[model samples]
Target: MENDEMIIPELNNETIESMIYIIRGQKVILDFELAKIYGYETKRFNEQVKNNINKFPERYRFQLNKEELDIILRPKKSTLAKRILKNI
Candidate 1:
């Protein structure tokens, strides 16, 4: 089978900019935000990543530590989990 490059959808500049944040002193966007920008369901996006794991570097993804999660989750007036559920 001939290999074909997958085309990533164009993202709105403002929308993409807004999703970027500094976490652990590194600029990043959550998997969910990236999936949204790429017009994918978060679960499917993640599954694709797993299937093509070698395509991404270690720094490309990391789980939030407890302290980091607390710092982020605490400030949000609303529960992030609920917000995520509503969107999906």
Candidate 2:
């Protein structure tokens, strides 16, 4: 079958790679990234997560520490700061 016939949606390699990195044994997504993907604002994404804290266990979701945040945002800023600041 041709490549276009593949069942998986066609995504750019960078996006696929980012997904792989994000899903590395953890259900985590930065607020900005999740907002972009879900078509919501970053603040709204954080509000939902906060409202449904139980739905997001540590394994499913958690905020990054300053060091961790530094690592993630060093290359580029992420809206995760909103939640991280609150969680801390």
Candidate 3:
């Protein structure tokens, strides 16, 4: 294998089950995790999904409360909100 090569894991029941996360009573799979299963970079995977975002019934969306928004808009340079805000 070359330095740039990747080894895709087998998607058996256990592997898929391990990727599923339960948050707030809802099952979720992060896009980066899903992209890894198919051997695609996260940006490429997201671009493809963005082209057809509404096609899937299981697509997830969430709304932040006022307190959540306030935290995300904090002006500290080292805060995690910079990355989180970009994704929002």
Candidate 4:
């Protein structure tokens, strides 16, 4: 094969499994990941969706509840009011 046509290494099953774990386990990704892949910051990504909330729908994105936020901010003891902050 030509240099440009050289075969690239394939991701094995284990690598695929690890990718799935990372996506689901990491509740959120940083701005860098969004910018690199989707050409936007996490805040921008959220705002665009928020502006078109009807298009996105609740099931697609919804704020975390008090209990859910508690788990997220675990050991910090967040106030009930703060915990109910709307997530975009």
Candidate 5:
């Protein structure tokens, strides 16, 4: 596959479950997690989603506000997670 092409990743239930979080009373996966699952850089994944906005319904996508971002980042105990979040 080309570098820009996405793989049809086979995600196990445990892997998917680990990525899902309850935010705003809705189950959600962070964009970075989705990027990892589908073999794209987070920025590229977002670009693809925006370019093909019609493919994803409103319920499938939303931006994180500062508070929501905090909520997602706050519980993370890993320095790597913090660094990744900050860089992204």
Candidate 6:
């Protein structure tokens, strides 16, 4: 195989599985993790999502409330909130 044919080693089934979470009783992946998969920074990826918001319907995307966050996240609520705020 040519050097260009070599697979990128960082991507694996285990890593992909690790990024998925159950939120609001749905299996979902966060924007930052999706951004990494697509080789874009989180902010840039979110900007694209915002620009194309109409293309994504309600079933496709939604924000979490504090109650949903508590159920989905294992970390302390304050710690996760701080991390989320930093990403925003």
Q: Which candidate leads in TM-score?
A: 5
Best by lDDT: 5
Candidate 2 lands at a TM-score of: 0.56
lDDT of each structure? 0.70, 0.59, 0.58, 0.43, 0.76, 0.70
Worst ten-residue run, lDDT, model 2? 1-10
The root-mean-square deviation over C-alpha atoms between each candidate and the true structure, in angstroms, is 5.6, 9.2, 7.6, 11.5, 3.3, 6.1
Model 6 earns a TM-score of 0.66
Model 6 clashing residue pairs (backbone):
none
Which residue runs of candidate 1 sit more than 4 Å off their true CA positions?
A: 1-11, 74-80, 86-88
Q: How many clashes show up in model 5?
A: 0
Counting clashing residue pairs in each candidate, in order, gives 0, 0, 0, 0, 0, 0
Per-model TM against the reference: 0.68, 0.56, 0.52, 0.37, 0.76, 0.66
Write one digit per residue (lDDT tens) for candidate 2, span 3-87: 2232334546677557433434564657666555565556776788899988877676766677765776555555545544553
**lDDT by residue for model 5 over 1-88, one digit each (tens)?**
1265446455789878977888878899988777766777778888899999999999988988988777767677475376556537
Model 5 stretches astray by more than 4 angstroms: 1-11, 77-87
Error of 3 at 83 (Å): 16
User: Candidate 3, residues 1-88: lDDT per residue as tens digits?
Assistant: 1123344557778878865655556776656556666666667767768787786445384434676446434543364455444444
What's the lDDT for candidate 2? 0.59
Give the C-alpha lDDT of model 1: 0.70
Q: With candidate 3 superimposed using the best TM-score fit, by how many Å does residue 16's alpha carbon deviate from the native?
A: 1.0
Q: Tell how far residue 74 is off in model 5, in angstroms.
A: 1.6
Q: Over 4 Å off in model 6, which ranges?
A: 1-9, 70-86
